[model samples]
Each structure stands twice: as C-alpha cells, then as structure tokens.
Target: MASQNRVDLDGNPIKPITICMIGAGGFIGSHLCEKLMAETPHKVLALDVYNDKIKHLLEPDSLPWADRIQFHRLNIKNDSRLESLVRMADLTINLAAICTPADYNTRPLDTIYSNFIDAIPVVKYCSGNNKRLIHFSTCEVYGKTIGSFLPKDSPLRQDPAYYVLSEDASPCIFGPIEKQRWSYACAKQLIERLIYAEGAENGMDFTIVRPFNWIGPRMDFIPGIDGPSEGVPRVLACFSNNLLRHEPLKLVDGGQSQRTFIYIKDAIEAVLLMIENPARANGHIFNVGNPNNEVTVKQLAEMMTKVYAKVSGEPLLETPTIDISSEEFYGVGYDDSDKRIPDMTIINKQLGWNPKTSLWDLLESTLTYQHRTYAEAVKQATSKPAAS
Candidate 1:
C-alpha cells in the first residue's frame, strides 16, 4: 500500500512520521522496525546500545528501506543524546528494560534501576516535549492474580473474575518485599503509575502496553553461542537451549505457573495499530496478549519438546523434562506469578486488535526457527573439549 493510501482505524489518512525507537535492537524492537520499513513510509531513528539483532536491517546500504531507518548506538542510562532524539521524532517508543526473570531476584538493584530509574528520563523527555509516547511494560506488573491466593481446590480459582487481569479492573498484586522477584514488577508498576500521572496531570499523550509473553524468533540469545555461558534467559530461550543441546528441560517448581503467550508478530500488529490510531489508544492501558493461548509452564515444556523433536527430526527423549526447586534454579528469594490471562475487552474494542496465533502453531514455527538457527551451534559447542 502506498503511503498516501494508508488509513488508520477511523479512516483518517496516516501521515509519515519519524519514530524515536529506543531499544530498537531488541527482539520486539527489531520486529517493529522491520514492519515499519517494509510496510509503512514512516522513518525510524533506531537507538540502542547494540545492533547485533538488527544488523541485517542496518547493513547493505543498497537495501530498499536503507534510507528509512538509522541506527544510533547509545545507552539510554546517562546519554544526553536521548532527549534530542526524543525531540527529533514525533513519537517515542520506550522498549528498554531489564526484563529477564533470572536477574529480577539475583540482581534486584540493577533490575530496578534499569526498569524504573533509567526510564524516568524517557518519560520526562516525552512529556516535556509533548510527544506521543508508547511505553512497553511487562504483564508481570499485574503480578499474581487474586485467584492465586484462593485455596487450591476452590471453585473461584477457575472463575474469570478472579484470575483474568483487566487493565481497567484488576489490582496489581505482588509478593512480600523479601521475595525480590517482584523487584522488576514493582519498578515497572511505579513507572507505569508515573506515566499515568504525567498523562493526567500534564496532559501528555501516552499509551501503555502490558505485553503477555510475546515470543518468537530472535528472542534472547542462546547460551554460550551468543550470551554469557552461565546466563539464564527467558523461559522460551531456556527451553530452546535445552532442546538445542538435547538436554532435558528444567521445570522450575514443577512449572505449574500458567501464562498466556502472543506471537511477537501478532503483538507488533497491535502496536502498529496503537501507533497509527492514537485517538483510540491514548489514555488507555492496553493488555496485548492471546488469552486463548494459556498454558502452564509444564504444558509449554511438553509442547516445546514435541515441537522441537518434529522440527529437528530427532526422536523425543524418554525424560524430556526434569523438575527442580526454584531455589536451586533461580536461587533464593525467588517467586512467580500463579497465572496471567490478559483481559482482551479493552484492546478488542479500542483497536479491534486480537491475537490470531494458537499455542501449538506458534510453538511449531518458533521451534523450527530455533532448530535451524542454533542446532549446529549447540552441536559444535558441545563437541569442544572441556576447559581445564
């Protein structure tokens, strides 16, 4: 479609606007950059400390959208360039955060600082400059659902009213302060509150996105191959590393915590809708997720095992998963959300956005990519002689 013919949800023709996309080298950022370049006439000032994931889009100056995107390497923490970049663009999307679960408990201070303190300036710059802001927050901010506090056998535990997290209705619940796992969530919730206050008190145009486990290709790095050998990544990458090395998936505390996942592509579509249709999206905290794709971590592991086996052309292991206590895997002060099922009413009505992928189908595609990308690397790493 031509830029002239591009229309938003309300039939308003969308204008080409430059977007200052912080953390543009991350998984979601990379995908969003691709979408904008391939489909829209909008320009992106991509800012991130690293461009490894988005190198494909940056290099080969002869590419069609080469002129449409520019990568600037800078850390948002203390960089004076952040404010200027935010001023340069009509819209700012803040996707920078320390979101990995492993760091939440072990590196609580860094997690809090990265997620909350570092984001303070971004929010301020957008508000001060009167720029439209699309801030990415995690579904973790919702913390554990109310139903989780109910008795294990209680009938209310199965009720949607108890567990379904509504952006407008549900309360944000977190464990005691000592849990430390809630550090990231607590920081995010604070930042979100600050953003809301800015919107209300200062009349800043802002949209908050609480993503529910957006997963797909180019997500967190594979162990040893890309990231630190001992670093623990998100659940999908953790399981992918295990599958790649033909090792049993480790199930933290029997992996009973349930979560809903949306394909990164599907979620990005919703984001694009928010970007184009600001009238409907602004002043609204939207939950971007596929409620229909809910599954316990154990179920996710089983499904991933099957999908990896099929994709890799390898036989399924007799013992595909091993249960380990959270203390052993994540260290002390670890906690988890009992369930996360985003209420889709607001997003559906506001943006007409609904995630379209099924769990099995998404796992199939993701696992196929994982196998193709990391299987050989894992094989080579494992074949190397052990260090003395």
Candidate 2:
C-alpha cells in the first residue's frame, strides 16, 4: 500500500516497465513477482519451464495485477519464443539456470548447458534487440575466497582484503576441471564474460547481479514431498527437510565452510532498485548480500534446529547434525567455498541499498513458513506408505 507513492532516487515518478523475466517461477523470481504486483505498477512476462512456485499469482484473475502478469512457460534452452519475448519487453531479466549443488558434480553436462550454454541465445536476443538486460549471475561465480588458500592459523586470513568478495576487485577463482563442483561456477563465469563482451562490443545495456546466500520462504522444495526424493537443494531447504523429517542435518566436510545469508525479501529490494535505476545500475556488477549475517554451515544447522523447535513445537535433536566427508556427501569432484562475505561497496554506492535482516530473525520466519506449508505433508510422506 505504501508503494502508491513510489518515486526514483532523483524524485522522478517511477514509470511502469514490462519485464521479460526468464525463470520467473524460481525462488528469487517468485518473490520478485510478488513484490512487483503488490508494490509497483510494472508488468512481468513471466518465463520458466515450471510455474508451481508462482501459481497463486497466475490464476483466477481475482488477485490484483493479474492483467499485468503473464506466464509464458518458456525454456530458454530450446524454446523458439525466447527472442520475441525479450524484444517485446522493455527489459529482459534472465534467471534461468541449474543452480543446486547436487547436480553440479553428478550432472555436470546439464549444469554447464543450463548455466552457460542455454543462456547464450537469451543474451544474444537481448543484445540484438537492444533490450536492456539484467542477468542473474551467482556468488558461486566468485567460486572460492583467497583466504581459503592460506594456512588455517594464518593471521593474514583475518584481513578483509583476502576474503570479502567485491564485484569489481575480487578474483574469480574456481577449482580445477576435476573438482567438478566448479562446473556451475565456471559456467557462470563464462557467461559473465560473454555478457561483458556483449556490452563492450555490441553496446548491450546490462546489469549483472551476484547474490550471496539469500534464503527465506518458498525457497526450494523438500525432497520426497514437492521435489524429487533424491533432490538436494541449497543449505536452507536441505536442513529444513532434515528437521521436518526428524532426521539429523547432513554436514559436508565437517560443515566448516562459512557463508553469509540475506533474507530473500531484503535481497529483492536490491533487485527492484536495480530494475528501476538503470542509469545507476547498468555496466555494473552488484554483490547483493548481508555480510553481517555470516556463519558456518554447522552453525546454521544448529541454529535451524533450535528455530524449527520453536516454530513447530518440536523438540530439538540431541545431535542435530551428522558430519560426513565431501566425497561421501556430494560424491567425487565436489568442492566448496570456504567463505562468502560480500563487500557491499558497489551495490551501496550504485543503488543506495543494504540488506537488513539478521540470520536468526530470517530463519525464524523461514522455518515458520516451512512448518506450516510442509510439516503435515512431511509427516504423511515419512509414515511407512500405508503398509502397501
């Protein structure tokens, strides 16, 4: 309701712009779609292979902004309609990709194709059509931090210069070809290069977003419930499923790897700023994440255990998590970033944006959604299948 009086940073009334949102049914996309419909007058040409996540927004025509939103059910990989959709909109936001870590090593080919190859035509379409493009790259593109290579006891590791990922300054270091965990990161890096090349040679207007661990409700599916039984989503959903099923969270490599998480709602605000402030955003790569909410994977698991107990009235597990080697958990060729703390200089300077939610507060809200939405279903699923 407060969005009725929206204005740009320069005190200019924000004009509604149609966006061709590729992968508009994923975690980030669903939230963005919700924000746009509720808060802004913009139109979304929602594109994705699936629409289960955004189903509420697409149907019945009773909800507001129904006319302003359309679902294309388009796959950028082989879809013939990608170009036309990009050309029709004022901006094309490509969020389509295979981002989960499980598939990176097990399904490297699909990972590469989805993350990089599939994105080529989308980039080309936007460039050729002269449509402004906002490509959703990942913090995974940063791969690993410099401090990760140093001795564990090295005091130099404390220096922010060694670890803080900066959009303009940080080096993109990834594991070797064998450590196929880098497949997604490598693919994303290549695409980022290609996008930069497009901007340099073809003069494409673009903004690249590198999001740190943004987690909240409707993030990912719980395996054997809404998603495949063997599906492994990011850390949040992974731990949520374990908690809901009364099982221990699986920690890989002692869960020592550190990460920073921002509330998805907070992160979406940064994206909206990028969407409206093209003058400030274009030709820049923004790292949108909360450096203040840093924690180890083990710490995250422990925190979630307590949070779920509070939300669902369930008792916390005595041993909330079980540690396993990277080889056993992720299989061979899997590696992880030691840390991911975004240095917010670029995004702050460009969009005047900053993430606000604390980790514990974000997790509390997220677990409440998880318990309400999936706890009953998880109970039924884990029940012995009705004795056949």
TM-score against truth, every candidate = 0.99, 0.98
Please give the lDDT score for candidate 1.
0.94
Spell out the clash pairs found in candidate 1.
none
Tens-place lDDT digits, model 1, residues 211-252: 999999999999899999999999999999998988899999
Model 2 misplaced stretches (Cα beyond 4 Å): 1-5, 386-388
Model 2, 1-388: lDDT tens digits are 3266688877888888899999999999999999998889999999998999999998889877889999997667777888888889999999999998989999999999999999999899999999899999999988889998999899989999899888878999998899999999999999999999999999999999998988999988999899998888888999999999999999998899999999999999999999998999999999989999999999999999999999999888988999889898789999888899998988888889988999999999999999999999988887755665
Displacement of residue 373 (Cα, Å) in model 1 is 0.9
- How does residue 225 of candidate 1 score in lDDT? 95
Cα RMSD for predicted model 2: 1.2
Worst 10 residues of 2 by lDDT: 1-10
lDDT, candidates in the order shown: 0.94, 0.92
